[model samples]
Target: MNNAKKYNIKIAIAVALLLSAASFTFLEKQEINSKDNLMEVLYALGQDYPEHYIEKPDSANIKRGYELIHVGKTKSADGIASKAISKFYTCTSCHNVEREDLDLTLVDQDARLEYAMENKLPYLQGSTFWGIVNRESWYNDDYILKYGSLVDDAKNSLKGSIQLCATVCSQGRELEDWEMTSILSYLSTLQMKVEDLELNIAEFEQMNSLAESNPDSAIAFIKSHYLSKSPATFAELPESKEKGYSFEGRPQYGKAIYELGCQHCHHAYGESDLVLDNSVLTFRWLKKHMPDNSKKSIYEIIRKGSYSELGHKEYMPNYTLEKMSHRQVEDLRAYIESNVK
Candidate 1:
């Protein structure tokens, strides 16, 4: 072949190789994105229903056991046995299924849910049950200080843990032997199969430190780092605002606050009978019991907390202005008013 013909062939071959490399790069990126998306969904599902994701031996007793743990009571507990108790706090109350990471003070209502569902958010103190079965010891901190190290024997440790939780946290009666066995069996299902995504603790701590001084910017930092999304991305979503409130006081926004702050104690949804306590606060109960209470009253109760007519401080902790602002209080009030039926 002539020099000119050879040069043309070389150019054609070079172009072909470049095209192949570009195609491969595109496919590889697409694959990575797909895996990331799948992982996000799986993480969200596991957080939302750790019990459903965990593997367990199939059995009638196991099924019943799972139900009992989830509900905080058995089917047999009814009538006066149920009515005498004011609340029915359960395992799920403190150990919520999903991790909540959104800084509700900054994120709008819908974006908060979207981020949570997308596995970009983290929960507060509630320990996720996803890997509880594998834990060598149960209660941490003060419980260890009080009870000594968790019992070594798996069965005994579980039983002791349940006993402490029931008698101490719930302030309720002890579980029967059968109840313990069933619940333990159910717990066994919660062993972790894969590592779960966790919030960057350092980043979270920084947000906390900044929260008192620059609450808005602190939330923006959380959105950018922990959520792996730009703060501006959330801003583009439709604004959900209430007329009288300084911040967005949409019921949805209130719902997020309630879920994080109140729902664990209040037990408004599902089988009200299964709640940890019957006397736990609910919007309807509040309206009836404290008919004279206004938004200011609610805000004060949240900020300073409440005391019984007998002068004893109530179970709730005071949410200081640092932790929750007046705007959040308004959102909570909006949520309560809308939910009262």
Candidate 2:
């Protein structure tokens, strides 16, 4: 064969091989996705009670419950009081089922409690639901156990607690009966599944890489992935008139901002700790520790974030313009000041 013909054939062969490899990779990815879907379905089916049980969950209902827990929302709103209305936050926002690699302890005390609690380490949301199925009572303090109440006594009962979370924490309307049942059914499935505890580090690595290039897209992708995993059980309801925050003044607005952002680490009013920097940032603590209690200094700290004297960035994430506006920061300052005795 001529030299040109020989080279042409070689190039063609290489191109063919490349296409074949690409096809194989695509098929492998499809197979992995199919397996993931199958596993999820099986997991849902396993949630059903045995024949001996008088009340058993339907697989479809169980799956719907999963969706409700992970992504269901009645409306969409903004700001702190409007948070409960947001579609972005759900039960999974605080009660996660997955294991992540980050040292969450640096951000929240709930994560540190894992060492003392063993398999009960907090979920990514800073609390674990492992063996939650066996717990006769819910909540960290066990309101039911201590108060001898059922799950609907308000804030104390499981149903009441769920309602409070929806209204206060999420800043949305109360969950409907079907939605509650679906969520409870899903929670009932939270057993000590050793295999599920295995962390998908690769997923996190991919997310980190994407976040570096496109943070907004990365956030959307994560939310979409979770949402797609569980189809919504109900149509989007009309937005409720309930204002998430009273907004009596700037301090209330700031409290809303604090609840939305800082509360995850600082916790409640008096629950701040040194490890999480909560103690230093609480309204009272900040007033005592900071020579200047002005809003400007507080805003600067939040905007730039706190670092150790050694120049190391603390675990607390910075609040950039992209994350919160200056007005919001001012409100946060107002909220902190209000907390002061």
Which one is best on lDDT? 1
lDDT of 1 by residue, 128-206 (tens): 4544543334554332333344323222354676676665545457776656666665554443222122335565455
- The top-ranked prediction according to TM-score is 1
Candidate 2's residue-wise lDDT over 1-341, tens digit each? 47985576455434423322222121233112211222232223233332111134454445555555644532211221112233335565555544322332122222323332344322222234433442223333332332244334443245665665565444457776766665565554553221232327676565445545665554443433321111111111112212212233366545545554455545433222432233435457654533343322444355444322343322332343423444554555556566665
TM for every model, in the order presented, reads 0.39, 0.33
Show where candidate 2 strays beyond 4 Å.
1-54, 74-88, 98-126, 139-156, 192-341
Model 1 off-target regions past 4 Å? 1-58, 75-87, 98-125, 142-158, 195-255, 263-341
Angstrom error at residue 18, model 1: 48
Give every collision pair in model 2. Answer: 81-244, 81-245, 84-170, 84-171, 84-172, 85-171, 123-127, 151-158, 254-331
Q: Distance from true position, residue 186, model 2, in Å?
A: 1.1
Backbone clashes in each candidate structure, one number apiece? 15, 9
